[model samples]
Target: MNRLRTLLFSILFYGLSVPIVLSVPVSALFGRAAVVRHAHVWALMHRMLYRRVMGIRVRVEGVVPPGTYFFAAKHQAMFETLELQLLLGGPAMVIKRELSKLPFWGWAAMQYGGIVADREASAGALRSMMREAKALKAEGRSILIYPEGTRVSPGEQPPLQSGFAGLYRALGMPVIPVALDTGIVWPKQGAKRPGVVTIRLGEVIPAGLPREHIEARVHAAINTLDRG
Candidate 1:
């Protein structure tokens, strides 16, 4: 019965996401106010979907800093992207190319200030991302990114990818390490399990740190949560 419910809800969730994303332009034409409202509305809907369909509750810790600092969070579940802004305000994400292929979601994500990347297009992608990140920072938007590049399985830990270190070095931005235990509840590719997921915010790793140091600190912070 649980499986049936989850499957049904999952189907509905993905089915609706497409149209929602594609309607961004139409939603914007209604006016700027409408677009802002739509983003907030969708954030709420995203929370509801995860709670109802995925059976996962989020427990956040520590205070989210003000202004634009890069958020280096652990990636372990599909819900990470959706629930990013739940408690943290003004936070937009750096997402991968696969998300952009989903018809409606891709559009909506773009509209709501997400930074999408085409991993295959290395040089071009980095240039574009750096430009956007700087511009968005000036506009007071926090940038959230999963430094690991891909979701880690429940029993496995993936090394933090180099892109994050490169971004920090290039952007010269402070980074907040967010530790989360999401795999237990929202497994990378499996049935959702009912559980409470805790996301703990660590100390700020200031900018200008050496590349090797930045990589090590970020990796340690994420691994701390994975073990806890």
Candidate 2:
């Protein structure tokens, strides 16, 4: 049964992931680039398991923009969190502060160039996030954020989280909105279905737009694949 397959896949995937996550410290010893490169391997491993075990395939459409740009994607399942990073050639992520402090995974993510955002939105936290974002950009890396803050079911579309707009204004990178129907295949709390999860990149929205304008544009763009 599919439940048996999902259970087996989860066991294999997470159990196997420990070694690579543990190896992050060794990579970090080499430097940031080393750590980022090491992360690619981890992401690849997860993708392979998703395909080989769960029969899930990711189909990405539309050209990834040429240079530095902020990417906002609809959060439907856990798939896109790391998949998009791999798809974008390891761009820095904007993760929540708590997640950025986990253990080896958190440490590795930070070393791999993630900006840790504080959900409470203190002035200091925002400033820290801005500094990290600028550092990533300075290194020619873009940022990938799930603007709705948390994953929603496939048919639901939540408004963009405030942090996304703030970061967009701070970084001023052109936005590339990505839409994915990941929940159809990987639900929040249910059996995993085997199917193609589509990630579509919508038209670019230029930087420096008014907050209201950019927010609306992003809200519409990242939900393009949602039938609702």
Candidate 3:
């Protein structure tokens, strides 16, 4: 049954994640890049588990651009969080500051060079996020951000949060809008179904566009992957 498969996969996935998460501190000793490479391995392992245990397949469409760029993606389920690190070759993630305050995982994420945002801080958060993002950009790392700020169901489309536009303008990198229907198979907080999740990469939205234009374009591009 779907429920049985989801439960089994969750147990195995987290069971495997124990050693990977614990090894973060050891990886940090080598440097931030080392920690990032370890994170990529973690993500890859989870992807492999998903395929083997849950019968979920990931199919990517469109071109994934090269070089350091900003990635604006739809937030549907936790699956993409694990997939992006593998797909983007250890790109810097835009995550909540609270998540970075955890135990070992938080320490590793900090060393891995994530751009942490204080969601409740509004404008101040955007400023802080951009500052960190710029530093990561200089290191030639792509930035991955979920513009919706949180997971939404597969068919619902929401306007991007304010931080996305701010980062796009301040970072001055081409924005790669990505859309995926992971929620159709992996619901936010329930049993996952067996299916192929398609991730579609939209054409690069050139930098220097007006705020409204950028938001509109990304919003539409991401929703294009929705099933309904």
Candidate 4:
């Protein structure tokens, strides 16, 4: 049954996504606002279909504070990437240089406030990220980043990438660590399990802490749901 649902959802998703992406250029003519809304609708379709067809549900445990913030979230699957854009109202999301270098979708990512950077742990990369982040904040958009930099299996606890700590301190942005249990359902190359995915918005940690302390705090906070 789960496999059937996953197959059905995949079919419907590709059917919807291809045309939606193709329409983005037309959306661009109206302005950035239109493009962003176009992106939102794309995210919405994901949520709608995931719930109705896949029987997967999402539940939040805390209120997301108002105003612009740097949201550091767990990377369990592709689910949170788009869903958070809907939950956070189109924050500028961090993407790797590889993903940003993709074809049309890559160009569209920028229009919707993508901050592209290399995953390298170097001074130059950190400086580049801060530059992109400051520009996004100026646009009145929050920044959403997966500090570990990639998806991990549920219960796997990994140290954050160096870029997160450097970017947080240099940018001086407060952090809102988010924890979610999406991987239990979304993990592996198989059908997605039907279950509730819990997202917890942890207490805000202000900037200026030493890198070790900040990293420790965020590492623990974003893994609140990790059974390991």
Q: Candidate 1 vs. truth: CA RMSD?
A: 2.6
Candidate 2 Cα deviation (angstroms), residue 18: 0.4
TM-score of each: 0.86, 0.96, 0.96, 0.95
Candidate 4 or 2, higher TM-score:
2
Instruction: Output the TM-score of candidate 4.
Output: 0.95
After superposing candidate 2, which stretches have Cα over 4 Å from the reference?
none
lDDT of 1 by residue, 1-228 (tens): 557656876887777765665567877888544554676666677778778876768888888777668889888876776676756664767878788667666766766666776667488887887777677666677788888788887556677766687678777788889888888877656577777999888888899999889888988887776752
Candidate 1 C-alpha error for residue 71, in Å: 0.1
Better of 1 and 3 by lDDT: 3
What is the lDDT ranking, best to worst? 3, 4, 2, 1
Q: Please provide, for model 2 over 68-126, each residue's C-alpha lDDT reduced to its tens digit, 9 standing for 90 to 100.
A: 88988898877888788788778898888899889767887888998998988888988
Clashes found in each candidate (C-alpha, N, C closer than 3 A) = 3, 0, 0, 0
Cα lDDT computed for each candidate against the true fold:
0.75, 0.87, 0.88, 0.87
Q: Compare candidates 2 and 4 on lDDT and give the better one.
A: 4
Better of 3 and 4 by TM-score: 3
Indicate the residue-level lDDT of 50 in model 3: 90
Which pairs clash in the backbone of model 3?
A: none
lDDT measured at residue 91 in model 4 versus the true structure, 0 to 100: 84
